[model samples]
Target: MAIPKSAERSEVGAHQGSGEIRLVDVTKKFGGSYAVQNINLTIPHGSYCCLLGPSGCGKTTILRMIAGHETPSSGEIFIGDQMMIGKRPVERGTAMMFQSYALFPHLTVLDNVAFYLKMRGVGKEERRQKAEEMLQRVQLDHLKDRMPGQLSGGQQQRVALARSLITNPKVLLLEEPLSALDEFLRLKMRGELKSLQNELGITFVHVTHTQPEAIALADMVVVMDTGRIDQADTANVIFDRPKTPYVARFMGGQNVLTGTVESLSGGLARLRNADGATFEAATGALEAKAGSPMSIAVRRDRIKLRKRLADQVLSAVNEISGIVDSTEYQGSYIKVTVDLGGGVFVVNVSDSEYFVDAVVRGDLVTASWTTADVHTLSKVDMGAIDDPYLDATQ
Candidate 1:
């Protein structure tokens, strides 16, 4: 893919001399259980990285360790070339933006921002000037005299941001920073956060469980699952070519199909499940033979649904017959859920195309996808693909 011009531009207006981070053999254990297990990752200088996962998945533990609030039970962490095991947060050239905003309710915005400078023992006049400049950068200069209680949620967040950046830290660590905002404000801040990071040209390590949040802001996405990494790569690669079934299902928008390979010939392979239901798939880079287990995933949007007719059981190759259990109008497209007796699958059809589609609720339909859209899976339960949470969709 061609590089975008915005990405190729040189970084000339940036604070903080270094933003590189490296972690090697990092592990954290708590009461006979490991919160993080032997994690090794490197975030490039001047980049945006998001540690993405669900609750109790160790993403927050890793973030806290990076921010110097938690010490790792094992391994080394480096900010630039300096080891950060025993260092204080400020000493490590890093700053943290907490989820609560943690603004001082009693102090005015100017005082809240300049408090960091006060602790460093800077002159009052100079510190005030620096704080004023940071406030202007966040566009909160006019609210300098407002206390935290008097400011809006977004305004308070900007004040917190100004305080965090005044120290000129090499890297900024954000722990669920937007998780406290309302949905509308959360989305608005996402763009503001990304734009701020790009303008400053500093590394921002953000933690969040939201998939869309991770994909939108991250230059590098580190997806964690129960104390281990499922995949770590660019958002595009992780979304397009997931390496396992768990990643496929967790990342959303992919259907993980599993069965036994029945036969392989002429670069095509046949698969059959216990019910004798059959399908065809591509043999891409897989050395296949009869009776071998197979697991693959196809993008949800790639599937085409056709109304099933008597004696018509299959498409040209990969086909699945199911009952349309639900349909959701998603503005640009429609989400169609189909139940294949033992499993459930979802397909996204364009709104214009779906209005003319013959399949409807409770109707028998066959969902078909091409072999080219098939991607093999490695680690994860290949049992069935049924999402209980999806049953509650509005």
Candidate 2:
């Protein structure tokens, strides 16, 4: 895709610099309650960062602060080298694409995209030409004359993206931009957003509550909780080795287990749950003692499940005997939920392997995983145990 001339021209501006963002000890309070507390983050220049969490976790609040829509109660925000606390949105060199699109219903797509340039006193013909170039960049030039109400959801989304890009922003803040689209459109637009960010080479800070969306699109995924950040890392690291139980549960592909340490030997800790179920996990560098609480996580796909013999005893380590609570066919894999007495554990079996000897609900099953698959989790206050925004179907 050709770079927009406006973006090229804006590169010469004195404020233009590498689009790195820094939030130092930022906090926001609303009537004695904290919305975000002590948030310190640095998004690298030209990276796609996602602030991921459930509703009211302060992801959007952070985005608004970055866009200059909301001021931090304390601390400082910087884009490149410029302080953003008291600057206007334009002065911050940022543009926001709202969740609702927020396009003018009465304006044509061209006029809507050109609105930013118009506000800056650009001539009508010049702004129209620049807007047309941006529309073509987003592949919506043909729809330039159409009203916002006349466009489809996906088309309207492109228009909004075009409008944001037309500003030639150093950082683009997206507040659930795909939340309104249907599943199909959301998937399609995800690729477009990534590609556009790459072509533009600008920092993209997206706020979302969906785990898959964050994992799929982000170079760095910052998992937020109630007024605090829980984890921030690459998608692979966040998924494969979550730092805390809250993140493991929120990411939805790991089963978290809690037990008391029975013994520590050879860099491995043997733990026993209240039910006397034995589990083993790598101690790594963490200090462990007898009778101390320990938490471990195992990926759902790493578990092996098989029918249990009537008299067969389960293993003392890395194994659990449970009854199948439910099974969901997910095309490539089958999601099996097993009731492990006081708790439920989820296992993902390939469809081919699952069909060989499929176990239905109510079946007696023993699920086991290798010790290498177990990951020690930090003992922290698990935030928002139940996320109302989590999509059950996802």
Candidate 3:
């Protein structure tokens, strides 16, 4: 549906508060290829929304479209009720924070932030005062006189944010703003960024290639794939109940197995694996008809590993016997790979409990999990899957 155009533009003489933004059927094409396609999103005032995806997945394309760096091939952009088509980004009450931290090498931190304000004909005294205030907000007040090249990566990012926010934009479009930082600095900056967003109460639309970055900072997360949105929801919902196989696997390491329901009774179904093993799992939204093939998934950490004989474990439930194939140390935890006939299944345990030398590759092991941990998916109805954008290809 087409959004109604805004009745009138705000008069420059009047200072007005920011408004909500809506993008309807936004699409962008680069020659014959689509950079982004059929994107519909609403950024409510004072909300932090994140566009999350892997490389070449159209996240940056969507950000560019909103920032007016790339015009939509065909769509309507709305700022509150105002139509933003053919309008420059600066006129649309929005500002951009690029990944490169586009600060001038010769310009001091304070001057870099004050550059935009000065261009708007704001007085030098007011602009300097405002820049200092922004610098303080970012905890970079002491570095005001330092040049961009003289500051660290995190410090430079603070300068970029201070510059973008000095204009007090209604909508802030950030494209992988923390990508240039090291791992430790990225985590520190993530907290600072979230705090800054909440304090300002401005609409923030951030784009990031890293999953944890989006998951940590977003009020709403939009996962994109192949120029389309795979899912849009809260982090809790996306993580707990991913709608598709692709999404389930993308969120973390999940073990997906092909099987068919052999029997259903007492809120549980007996599934016969393609390799002829049988196990029981809890029922889910996609009901498995008898004899119909389906896919089952369980997170690696959710499965329990025990060094017991197969017969001693609870065989009626979702129990399987395997051999410990290998183990990898991951600092806080150890990833144990158990060979369950068809493929290697991974289980995560605390490093203190599961060790490299504790269990040998040839030792027999039994892996078991409850019905609540099992998620069922259907192969025939791919659309019925939870997270279609999850890149299982990875």
Candidate 4:
């Protein structure tokens, strides 16, 4: 099943420019409702891109469109400069691994992986050899004789991945491929997917509602709401500097603060919330006038919390006084939820720091963060407008 060294090199060289995918103003409509609207995106050749959102957000629809299972109502899809509107799945140079890892129950693992080749009328010996090589590549060659029903979830997933990859596709589409696995297996398979994509040098568009999964596996994370993209950027940029409030809250690990701008000073804007609690944020080129609405995000890990003393006075600037609503111990850190009069704020206290002086429920506390930890949010409405400050972990 081993490929010759020169042949492998030639195959690797041919991967260039083959995996790039572009969608321009692509919209899908069922009756009067839009599944996806004016979607414009480009997945770089050989990069891992994640389409992340909640249920009914159209992530799976986008994946299907790219796989040729669903057609856009308008606009265009291009895979390496070739239009994909009328192309069949096989002709589009893409393969899909569904969330269920669709495999024939009657077929053995090796036969399941070789099914596509069989459809193409390949010689049985050649298809079997190629399927064995693929199974070996995915480290599942030892279980090739087992039926799909006999394999574990992770094993079945690998078999499915091998089946899709054996087609020598330029792009691979995954629809929540890890949702069926338990937490432990999910983590294990997440690493395998990324490693496999890197080794094969093919574009991977994975759809998932899990925030951590998307951030961990994607080079580019596209956050969608309803049917439109809220923000699309690198994982770090998306998490550290989200473009909109929906994205900031959806990505978690951030406490969003909303207010009205009271004044603008030297590179700083002062804002006052409905409760009259004032805060300051570095306005980095944002044009804001008095009375304009504003919102800023502060990372939960960046805020420091302390139990408020009976007689100690608190500073109004860069600090919030609240009662500890709850605390949950995560392995490395403690998630502390503080009840501000109108809303809740969260802070991630390192276990070491929490053990030094931990505060419990009903304890009066003060949470403080520096201006440098604050990031201004764009006013652009990308849906999910009801409560921007709603704690994502909840």
Local distance difference test, each candidate: 0.82, 0.88, 0.76, 0.87
**Would you list the clashing residue pairs of candidate 2?**
none
lDDT sort, best first = 2, 4, 1, 3
User: Across residues 1-394, which tens digit of lDDT does each residue of candidate 1 receive?
Assistant: 1123343222112344567899999999998999999999999999999998777999999999999999999999998888989999888878898888889888889999999888978788987877887787777889898889998888888888878888677798998988878999999999999988887677899999888899999999998988999899999988888787777777788887778888888888888865566677777777777898887888889999878876874545577888899988889989999988887889888888898964678988888887888887765345534544322222
Q: What is the overall TM-score of model 1 with all chains considered together?
A: 0.91
What are the root-mean-square deviations of the candidates from the true structure over C-alphas? 4.4, 2.3, 6.8, 3.0
Error of 3 at 30 (Å): 1.2
Clashes of each: 0, 0, 8, 0
Better by lDDT, candidate 4 or 2? 2
The segments of candidate 2 whose C-alpha lies over 4 angstroms from its true place after superposition are 1-15, 380-393
lDDT by residue (tens digit), candidate 3, 59-170: 8988887788888999998887888888887888788998898898888999999998788888988888778876876678899999999999888888898787776678
Which runs of model 1 end up more than 4 angstroms from their true locations? 1-17, 265-269, 282-289, 380-394
Candidate 2: Cα lDDT at 303 = 93
lDDT of 3: 0.76
Candidate 4 — which residues are off by over 4 angstroms?
1-16, 310-314, 380-390
lDDT of 4 by residue, 237-321 (tens): 9999987878888999888888889999898999887777788998886787889888899999999999998787765788888
TM-scores for every candidate against the unseen true structure: 0.91, 0.95, 0.83, 0.93
1 or 2: which has the higher lDDT? 2
